[model samples]
Target: MTATPRPSESGLPIEPVYGPDALDGWDPDEKLGEPGSYPFTRGVYPSMYTGRPWTMRQYAGFGTAVESNARYKQLIANGTMGLSVAFDLPTQMGHDSDAPIAHGEVGKVGVAIDSIDDMRVLFDGIPLDQVSTSMTINAPGALLLLLYQLVGEEQGVPAEKLTGTIQNDVLKEYIARGTYIFPPKPSLRLIADIFKYCKAEIPKWNTISISGYHMAEAGASPAQEIAFTLADGIEYVRTAVAAGMDVDDFAPRLSFFFVARTTILEEVAKFRAARRIWARVMREEFGAENPKSLMLRFHTQTAGVQLTAQQPEVNLVRVAVQGLAAVLGGTQSLHTNSFDEAIALPTDKSARLALRTQQVLAYETDVTATVDPFAGSYVVEKMTDDVEAAALELMAKVEEMGGAVDAIERGFQKGEIERSAYRIAQETDSGERVVVGVNRYTIDVEEPYEPLRVDPAIEAQQAARLAELRADRDQAAVDAALAALKKAAEGADNVLHPMRDALKARATVGEVCNALREVWGTYVPTDAF
Candidate 1:
């Protein structure tokens, strides 16, 4: 029998070669618009990277705030255009390092930031107005953002000048990641409050980064990734509009996050299809008039799940290829995962090399010399149409089930992604997937490598700091502020104002989250979903 044709990661069939008929009935006029125009399939901007390269952001954080701060300074010195922070479990989960629940986990995955004091140290010497930061925090995203603003005020930086993004996508947490704090109803309400607060207090801040990155890492194929992510984006827009806000007010500030895997062509098609779908949804469905409101501007990170730990150094090549795919796909910003990440936290040398990967893509490659380089290619155009059709079909299913939150309650997205993950696992086990260092190429005596390790003493030190903070601050003021925050959470008032007051009064991240938890309660997954 003839050899079977290989299939794409999304289970779509790939032809041996594509020609003119691949896009036989495609209409360029309606499908592909000029760059910076409607249906931004070409790109969201006219010049694209021809004017300036995409922002090179390095995601780094580990151990204490002081240690993580040093890494940030070093990255800036090494030519990083932006900073993306990674917080430890305790901070992301809204617990002080000293909490009984936080024991043995402080500073294990990322940096432990308990209060404004830690936030201040996290950006001590960095200029808030000059540098754009992206914090990877979900359920406790609001608290960390307020603390950052507090630090900016301490540094004399105006709120409007403070530019950054907070990964405030809690819906994904409920679906894939397990960091959700409140139930769906309360969580969406809190997100609406964030949109309102950012509009008034922090106009430059990205209110939420509706993410497909986590879902992809959890094994979602390209179609599932964008379908679920854009579905959530639509839900957020609907919630904001229902709360009496215009689409243009917050949509312009809205952004997205996605993963760029080694499959360059398909990833490029995915990005283009995503822009096209979002543009159509905003214009036709929502009647959004502003061009900015219709644009699907997103940041991309190289796929962390695709890296292999067997031959850790080989990951550098994987990251470089993945980063190239992101650039070719027209991402606004990018974070290149270091080669050592599959093993442990990136060593200083590996982190610099990761930044260098982007630098090479920018200065060394001619790929940035043009915009939408593969716009008219028959194969890419056909693949874009195919992915678009697949994603739209999934999106329609989500809509039929009453949108993202309802589908999520029914465990639709989660179950779909799990099936995809299982497929990949099975293929790997059968050796149908050729992972070079894993099954195909075997070497008996591999060289030893020492991975970077976080100091276990960090937990005790953070606990001591929390104790000292409690001793020095006025407990009554903090208590009253927390009580007010709880009252606001219990009522219809915007809670961030009181939450900010509590943070400004030296309230711990856990305390602020606890106040809301008392009112909204926490999210516990049920088997029925």
Candidate 2:
């Protein structure tokens, strides 16, 4: 007899052969009506990629604004459809590049932006109205968005005309990522304020990219990633409605971020199921009337965690497969990870290769010719239902714990993810899971690879920039604006309006965040939450 088929990544057993009987009781009218319609199980858009390929947004930035600006220009020249900014640790954590906590980490992970001066340089020659930008930032997302708006206004572009997204989901920070700034209560308030501010000012902008990408990188199973992410999305919607905003008003602007792994089938199923869940939740639970509010439009990034330092060049193949999975899953936009990422920051050549991978998929493959190519396939449809049920069970548990915030405070999500991570690690070590070049297809004395590295001197250069900014700006204006910001944060006023004034006065990001911290305090994780 043949050996039993292995389980999928979400721990669902894969049947050796999937026939029509696999979906015997499935109802096409109820489960999936049509592409771009209710539930959105097939795809969010009717034409899907047949109309046009998804935006090939390449995420890049490191060292300083000047360096990152050069890279952005290069990416645009090389056919990147959109820009995705990656901020350094300091900027992500609401600290200036020169802060003591920011010491050596100044510009190591991503680009350093301390104030509007840097923000202006980051988009120096780039036209804000023409290009779509997605900033991978949270906590201080408001600060960066304000800075971009100021730059756009200076370039004669109105806030209404600017289009882009900010990864403003801070709840995920409490669940997986450690870049949190304020405590949960105040953090939720800030997010609600952002939703209202964007609706009134930057109506075209996606206010928050409620993300599960980080959780997946941190080793969450596909089901856990979708479940925890949707839970966070629901929490954000509730907070906005509680803050006196209509569900349809802010919900339409909401977007999501997920990771695409090399497991193509499971990844596709995960995305389809996630859209159905979000749509049902919006209509049934939240009473969202707008169709846009029900659509789970998302941006997908290929799995960086899956890339290996051993035989790093092989990551190119892995990335291609992952990107294909995302495209097949019908992502609205995608970011393909550079092959060289596991070693260090991607070299310019590797970054171009990542974008080219998407181009090849879009033009050279027939996957873009149809909407939901896997629809009606026995295996895919069955797996989609299985993943959907598994995710709903997890979401129900989250609701039982009084929603995402309550579950986070109880460390429920984090604990579950860690256990999943541990299992993966154990499987890999036991050779039960094959990771090519690491456990299988091993090679001794791998070829020498020189990865791109940040200049340590860049930190000192940023410190100098901060010093010059301080000496040139009017201290009184900054102090006054920051005081107003503090007053707004302490009370019921929208913090972004006054916060914008502070940045307009050339106030440093760290300074504005510090002012808020004094009023709101910071988050300290106690045991995994």
Among these predicted structures, which one has the highest lDDT? 2
- Model 1: per-residue Cα lDDT over 253-337, one tens digit each: 9999999999998999999999999999999999899999999999999999999888888999999999998998899999999
Candidate 2 ranges with C-alpha deviation above 4 Å:
1-3
In candidate 1, the residue pairs with backbone N, CA or C atoms under 3 Å apart (3 or more residues apart, or in different chains) clash, namely none
> Candidate 2's residue-wise lDDT over 122-239, tens digit each?
9999999989899999999999999999999999999999999999999999888889999999999999999999999999999999999999988899999999999999999999
- List candidate 1 segments past 4 Å from native: 1-4, 527-529
Model 2, residue 444: what's the lDDT?
92
Q: Of the candidates shown, which would achieve the greatest TM-score relative to the real structure?
A: 2
Error of 2 at 64 (Å): 1.3
lDDT of 1 at 38: 85
Each candidate: RMSD: 1.4, 1.2
lDDT of each: 0.92, 0.94
lDDT of 1 at 391: 98
